[model samples]
Target chain A: MITMTRETLFNLAMMAALILFPLWAWLADEPFMITLATKAVILALAGVGLNIALGLGGLVSLGHAAFFGIGGYAMGILASHAQNYTPLIETPFLIEGTKSMPVIWLVAVICSGLAALAIGALSLRTSGVYFIMITLAFGQMLFFFTISWPAYGGEDGLSIYVRNGFPGLNTLDPIQFYGICFALLALVLFFAARLARSPFGLALNAARQTAERVETVGISPYKLRLTAFVVSGMITGLAGALFADLNRFISPTMFSWQTSGEIMIFVIIGGVARLFGPVVGAVIFIALEHLLGGLSDYWHIYLGVLLLLIVLFARGGVIGTLTGREVAHD
Target chain B: MTDPMMTDPVLETRGISKTFGALQASKDISLTLMPGEIHALIGPNGAGKSTLIKQIAGGLRPDAGQVFLQGREVTGLDTPARARLGLGRTFQISALAMEDTVLQNAVLGALGASGRPFRFWRAALGDKDLRARAQDALERVGLQEHAATRTAELSHGQRRQLEVAVALTLRPKAFVMDEPMAGLGTGGSLRLTGFLDGLRAEAPILLVEHDMDAVFALADRISVLVYGEVIATGTVEEIRANPDVRSAYLGDEA
Candidate 1:
C-alpha cells in the first residue's frame, strides 16, 4: 500500500489553506475576492473531473464542455421552471416544478451520464485525433443549439433569482457558498485519487499502453474507455452545476469550445497525467489570470505565451517539475 | 500415428485455413492436442505457424474450417473469449503490460478463474488465495522473486518466463505459445525447457519454437511444416529419421 509522505502532507497543508483563503475574504469583507475564489474552486472541480479521463485513462476529450453545459442547463432550466411554478413545455399533459440543490445535482449527473454514454459510445470507436474531433463536434453541436434556442434565456443566458438552497446552510453568505465549492472540490479530488488506484483504473491504464495485452486478459478496451468516459462526464457535470450556482447564471458560453480549451489548459499547465497535477494547474492558472488580468487588458496574450513556453520547455508541467516524476509516464 | 482413440483432444484444428487476398497464409491445416502432451509445431519462416496459432487462439478467423477447445467449437470467438474458455496464449513479440509489475500481470490472468477481474474492486488485490495462486504460477517458471519487479526491467529470458507465468495463471487446459524460445540465451533455453517439462503434466502445450534442441528435448509429438502444409506429424524420433523432414529443415544441421 502506498502511504502518504511529507509531499502529501505539504499538499494537504496547501489544500487547507486554499479552503480557508475565501474565509479570509469574509473576515476582510472582500466579497469580490470571495466570489472569485469560489469560481476558481468550481472550475478546479471540473478540471479534476477531466483529470480522470485525460490523466488516468489517456483519453483527451475535447468535448467536456458539453457535459459541463448540460449539467448547468439541467440546474438552470429546472430551477427556472420550479421558480415560475410552470412546465418546460405545454407537453400537452403535465407540469414539473423546480428542484432543490441535491435534486438538481442528481438530475445533472443523470443528464450528463446519458450524454456521455452516447458520445463515448460513438467517439470511442475511433482513437487519438479522431476521438478528440468527435468530442469537439458534439460539444460544438450543444453549444450552438443553446445559443440558437429562443427559450430559457438561450444565448442571452438564464439567471437564478436566488441561489439553489443546500440543507441547513445560509448559502446567501459568500463564505458559506465558498465553503460548499471548496468541500465539493476536495471531495471530487479525493474520488479521482481513489479512481486512479482502483482495478478499473489499472485496466484503463493497461488499455492505454498495451491494448492487445489487456484484451488477452479478457477486458475489452472499448467497455473500459466508455465506462471511464461516462464517469468523467458526470463529475465534470457536477462541477458545472456548482459553477452555475456560483455565478447565479447559466449561458451558452458554458458549452463553448473555448471553455473546453481552458479546462484542458488547466490540466496540462499543472501537469498532465499526475494525481495532484490538475489541482496544481488550476490554482496556478487562476493565480496567473487574476494577477495578470489586474495588470493589463491583454492578459490572455500573456497566458497564451506562458502556456506555449511551458509546453515547449517544461514538458511535464509544474507538479512534474516539483516532484521530479515524469508527467507523461504517470 | 494410428492412435485416434484419444479422449477429447483439448484443442483441435480441422481444415483451418486463412487467406490474405492473393496469399494463402494457412491452408487446410488439421492438428489435434491431447492433454499431458507437448506438441511441437515446427515450420520455416512465412510457413504460417504464427497465422495458424492466431487462428487457434482466435486472434484471426479461418476463412475455412473450425477450431475446437475440449470438443466445443470456438472458431467464432475472439481472443479474450477464447481465453475465458481456457485457451491461453503467449505472443510472438511478448505481448505484456510492460508498465505493470510482474505480480500484477500474473494476478490479472489468475483473477479470471474466479470471475470478472475489474468488478471485484478492493477485494481482488487483498485476496490471499489469489496472491498465493499467482505466486505458485510464478514459482513454476522460477520467477517468484521477480514478482514485484516491473516487466520492462526483466531480461529477455525472464520476460519469456513471465509470459509463461501469465499463460499458466488461469490453469488453462491448452497453452498456445508463439516462439517461446525466441531471443533466449543458452541458459535461458535450458530454463524454458525445464519449465515446460514441469507444466506438461498439468496442461497440453502447443509450442512454436526455433530452438531444435529444446524442441527435440521436450516434444512428445512433433508436427513439421513447409509452405503452410504439415509435412509430417509423429514422435520426435520418427520426425528426426524422416528424409523429407531432413531435406526440408534438418539439412541445415548437416
Candidate 2:
C-alpha cells in the first residue's frame, strides 16, 4: 500500500493547482492570466534546474544565469536565422537554423550542458563562499561578453519575429503555449523526483551532507557534483529557451546576477531540497509581484520582509512549514 | 613466522614521512598490515597518529613515502580512488550523513562498492543487490532493527557501529579505522572490541586507537608511535613489555 505523507499530499495539491488554475484561466478567457501562469511555470522550471545543484548537491551557484542566457541565445539565434532564411554556419557543412521548438530545446540543452561542464569543472574545485563568488564571476563575464558581442543586438537584445513552432499546436495561442510549458515543467519535475531517489542522487546527496564520507565510500564528490551541475544547467537552459519564446525576446539581462538570485530565491522560498518547492515558490513569488506591484512602487520592501520571515523562521520554506521537518523516506 | 617475502601484506606503508612546517607530523613511518590481522596503532595525543593515518587514507599527501594496498602502490591516488581500490576507512569523528536514515547511509557505501553508482534511473533503495549488501552489513553490526531510523537519532555508539557497517559494505582488502573507540563508554568499547576481533578475519585492520584495553584485547600486533615514529611493533605481549612504549605512551598505566 502506498502511504501518502503530508509532503506528498501537498505536492499533489500543488501540481493540481498549477494545472487547474491555468485551465480555469483559459476557460474564463483570461489570456493574461494564462500568460502569467506560463511565466511562473517557466521560472519554476529554472528553479527546478537550480535545485538539483544547489539543493540536493549543495552547490551554491550564483552563476546559473550563464546557462539561462545561453539557452535564450540558442533560441534567439536559431529563430532569427530561420526568419532570415540563413544558415547558422555555412562552413560547418551548412547548418541551417530551424524555428522548431524541439530543435531549439535540443540546442539549448546541449549548449547549456557543455557550458555547465566547463564551468562546473573549474568552479566545483572550490567550495563554500568561493564557489558562490566564482559562479557569480562567470555569470558576470557572460553578461559582459553578450553586451560587447554586438552581433546578436548586444545590450539591446534579440527579438524573435515569430514564436517558435511546436508540431501540433498554435504557438501564438496563450493557452496552447501554457500547455507546452506546463507539460515540460511536469515532466522535468517527475524526472527530478526520480533522480532524488536514484543511486546517483543518493551519492550526490551524501556528498552534500558529508563529503569525506562520500570519498571514503569510493565515490568522488567532485565527479558527482560536476555531473549534477551539468544536469542542472541543461534543465535551466531549456527553461531559458521557453522563457525567451514566451516574451518573444532575448536579452543580456537573462544572464544577469539578478536572474540567478531569483532562481535561487524560488528554491529557498519553496523548501531547499523539496521536489515541488520551486513550483510553489515561483507561483507565490509571481503572485506577490503582481498583487503588490499595483499597491506601491516600493513593493520590494514587502518581498524583503516576507523573505526575511521565511529565512529566519521557515528555514524549510513553504513546503517545510506545511509538511513538517521529517523528510519522506521514499 | 610468516615470512614477508612469501606473503604480501594487505596494506603497507613504507618510509611515509610528512612535515607540517617545522614539526614533523610523520617521520619515516613504516608499518605493515598482514592478511587477517588487526594491527593496532596506539599513540598518545599529539604523537601524529592522525597525520600518519591521513597519508595512508589518502587525505594528505606525504612529503615522501609509498602506500601499498594488496601489494600495489597506490600512493598517488586520492581518497576516493584509494577507497575504490579497496581501502575502507572510518573517521575518528562520526562522518555519517546525519540527515539520511541508517539504511540510506549503508546503501551509499554499497553503492560506492557496486562500481557503477552513476546509474540515475532506478531507485537505489529498491535495488535488491545493493539493499542485500547494506542489509547484510547492518545485520552484522546488529543495526538492522534501526535501518529506518535517522542517523542523527542513533546513539553515539550506534553511529560508530553504523560506520563499521558502512566500511563492511566496501568488502575492502583492508580497513583503516581512526579512533573507533574515541567517544564510546566502557561497555561500548568492549562490544566494539569483540566485533573488531571477528572482522579482522575478513580484512586486516589498521586501527588507530586511544583505548588501550580495547587495543590490547583486539590487536593481533600492536605498533606504538611516539613523536611521529613507531618506537616498537610487536605482538601484544611484546608491545606491553617494550620499555620505549612504556615510557612514551603506556606510562603509569603500564
Candidate 3:
C-alpha cells in the first residue's frame, strides 16, 4: 500500500473541503446549495461503484444504470409497501416490503449481482466493441421495461412519503445523509484499490494484456472477468439505494441509457484506471452541470463540444492531464 | 539407459502431429528428456520446430498423439496448467509483461510455486519470502540490479535474460526454451551460455536453437528435424557425421 503523502494529502484536503460544504451553506442560509452537495455525494458514490469495473477491471459496462435503477426500485417499492401495509409486488406468493436501508442494500446487491452474472456470462464471450454493444443492449432492455411497466409509476416514477429508517441517525438531516454517502464511497474505493492489487487483479490485468499468458499461468480469463463484473454490479447497486434516498423518489429515468452513458463519461473524463479519477470526474461533472445550466439552455451542446475536445486531445482525463502519470499496475 | 531417464522423463512427446488445413506443420514427432540432459531440436526454417514445441508447451493442441510429464498425460491441458505441473517454456518472440518491472515479471513465474495468488488485499511488495525467491531467480540470470527496471526499458539481450529469470521462478523440472539466444550479441550469448551451464544440474532443458555453435557446445544429444520429421537423433558428433542430417539440415560444412 502506498503511504498517503504530498498530492494524496492535497487530494484529501479537497475532500475535507467537500465534507464541510454544508457548513458554508448553513452560514450563508443557502439550503439549496446544501441539498445539491448532498446529491453530488450520492451520485459520486454511484460513479465510484462504476469505477471498479471501468477503472480497474477494464470492463466497459454501459448497462450499470440497470443496477442503479434496481437499487432505487428496491428501496422505493419497500417504502411504498411498508406505508400501505402490504406486499410490494405479490403474484400468488412472494412477500417483500421493508423500509430498512440495510435490507434495501442487500436486496439491491443480490438482484444486481444475479443480473450481472447472467449478462456477463454472455457478454464476456465477446471483446472490444462487441462487449460495449452487448452491455448497452442489456441496459436499453431494462430501461424500456421500466418505462413500459405500470405498477410503480411506469415512466412517471414513484415518490416516497417518508425517508427510510437507519439504526440511529436522523433521516431528515442533509449532513447526516451526506455522511452515509461519504462513508460508503470511501469503503468502495478501499475495496476497488485492494482488488486491483490482488492476484485476481493481476490476472485480470494479464487477461487484458495477454489472455494466452494468463491461461498458461493456470487461470481462466472468463471466470476472473465475470467475478469482477458481479462485484462491480453489487457495489453499483448499493449506490442506487442511496440515490433513491437522496431524491426521496425513484423512477424509470434512473435506469435510462443516458444515465449509463453519463456514468461512463465521468470515469473516462477522470482517468480510466486511476483510483481517485472517478471522484474528481464526478466533482467536475456536477460543477459543470450546475455552472453550465446557469449559463444557458444550450448547455448540453456546449458540453458536447467540450467532450469532443477532451476525447480528441486529452485521452487520460483530468488526473492524467494534471499528474502526467499513467495508471501504474504492478 | 538410466533410471532417471526411465522414471521421470521430464518431457515426453509420443507421435505428436498437427495439421492446419492443407499444411502439416508437425508430423509424428516423438521425443523424451531425462533429468540433467540438454536436448537440442535443430531444423530448417520451415521444419516445424516451433509448432512441435508449442504442442509440448500446451500452446497448441496436437491433432494426434500425447504429451506427458512424469508419466502423466497432459495433452489436453492449457499452458498455465502445464506450467503448474512444473513445465516451463519461453517464447521465440519474447512473450513477457513488458509494462511491468523485471522483478514483477519474475514474480509472475514464481507466483505459481509460492501458492495462493488469489489474495487481492494483501500487499505482495512487502512479503519478504516472495521477494527473496524473486531475487534469487534474478541473481541466477545476472539481473538482480535490473529487477526494479521495467522490461520495456531493457535491451533485447537483457529482456532475453529476464525471460530466463521468469522461467526460473517456477523452479521448473524441465524448461522448453524456444530460441533463448536469439538476437543476443556475442557477449550476451556467452552470458546466456554460462547461465545455461549452471542450470544443467537443476533440470532437463529442451533447447530449440538456430545457433549451431551453442547447440554443439550445450547439447548432450542432438536431433535433426527436416520437413516436420526427426531425420536424425544422436550425439553431436554422430549428427555431424550423418549424411542425411548434413544434406537436409546442416548443409555441407555445418
Task: Give the winner by lDDT.
Answer: 2
lDDT of 1: 0.83
List model 1 lDDT by residue over A1-330, tens digit each.
767654466468669868678768788999988887887788877888788788777899999999999999998998899888878767787757465788888989899999999999999999999999999999999999999987779889999889989898988888888888888877777766666655676667677877777777666778888998999899889989888988889999999999888888888887777666667777777888899988998898988987898799776777766666533221
Between prediction 1 and prediction 3, the one with superior DockQ is: 3
With a 3 Å backbone cut-off (N, CA, C), the pairs that clash in candidate 1 are A82-A98, A270-A281
Tens-place lDDT per residue, model 2, B120-169, is: 89999999999999999999999999999999999999999999999999
lDDT of 2: 0.94
Docking class of 3: medium
Question: Which portions of model 2 show Cα errors greater than 4 Å?
Answer: B1-6
What is the TM-score of model 3 when looking only at chain B?
A: 0.96
Clashing pairs in 3: A198-B120, A216-B79, A216-B80, A217-B80
Best first by DockQ, ranked: 2, 3, 1
- TM-score for every candidate vs. truth? 0.93, 0.98, 0.92
Q: Output the lDDT of residue A248, model 3.
A: 88
Q: Judging by DockQ against the true structure, name the best candidate.
A: 2
How much of the true A–B contact set does each candidate keep? 0.38, 0.88, 0.47
**CA error at residue B183 for candidate 3, angstroms:** 2.2
Candidate 1 docking classification: acceptable
Comparison by DockQ, 1 against 2, better one: 2
